[model samples]
Target: MIHVAQITLETKGPRLLFLRKEDPVRFTWYEDLVQEEKETEVFSTTALEAIRLAYLYWKNYSFKTLNCGFRYTLPERDEHGNNALFHQMIASYSSMNGIYFDEDLGHNCFVNFASDEAKNLWKNLQSQKRL
Candidate 1:
């Protein structure tokens, strides 16, 4: 099961405090802590919430001019595998605007912004120090 937590734009921007400043997209997965384990892998809590908020705010400010798209993949794993996989994709009307988050059930999560528009929106959200 994929669990997602979201923050609405109308709410004060303090919710982003949960994220680390130098790297807002990456966060520790507190629920997965196993003291006995020799190693713990840090992960994103799924940046869907942040991305959605930014997308909504951008969409509103853009007068709903462009259509955005979202794709979700269910968590899955092979019977012989020990971990599950999760994936998410977002795109805008223009092929130039999009982002991809591939959480491969490991320490190295991949994030890519297809265009500057998508990158700017993420930056704008993270930089909201007062709003």
Candidate 2:
């Protein structure tokens, strides 16, 4: 019963709560908090699995760019001097995975895990700098 939500301006319905568009996506794992908010989409089994799926989505987008004449060695920069390829990959990944994304406002990927294992997994990923 893990719940996941993306902070976005758009709401799926009246029940969905919207966070500020600029808020960064965060991983939260607490039963009481989730219990308080009953409208969140209850999907996903664990935070680790959700994160791994996101990574795979990113990897899938990277492969698509490589095939589209984007360089793997030297990535092209966007107008903001950010890596264009990386942004593109992130956009694709976020959209495909039901995370919120805005070209101007930016994307924030948020997740809520229902189990203690998910909390440990998040801490482990953070310690390893893999998140």
* C-alpha TM-scores of all predictions: 0.22, 0.18
Candidate 2 backbone collisions, by pair:
none
Model 1 lDDT-worst window of ten = 31-40
Per-candidate Cα lDDT values, in order, are: 0.29, 0.30
CA shift at 121, candidate 1, in angstroms? 0.6
lDDT of 1 by residue, 1-131 (tens): 12212223354331221212125445332121122212113244454443344445435332111111233222442233222112221222223533233444333222232345434434443365311
Model 2 residue 65 CA deviation (Å) reads 28
The alpha-carbon deviation from the true structure for residue 35 of candidate 2, after best TM-score superposition, in angstroms, is 35
Best by lDDT: 2
lDDT of 2 by residue, 1-131 (tens): 22222221233321212111112344322212322533223223444344344335334233111111121211222223222222233333335553434344344432222234334533543466533
**What are the runs in model 1 whose C-alpha is more than 4 Å off?**
1-104
User: Model 2 segments beyond 4 Å from truth?
Assistant: 1-113
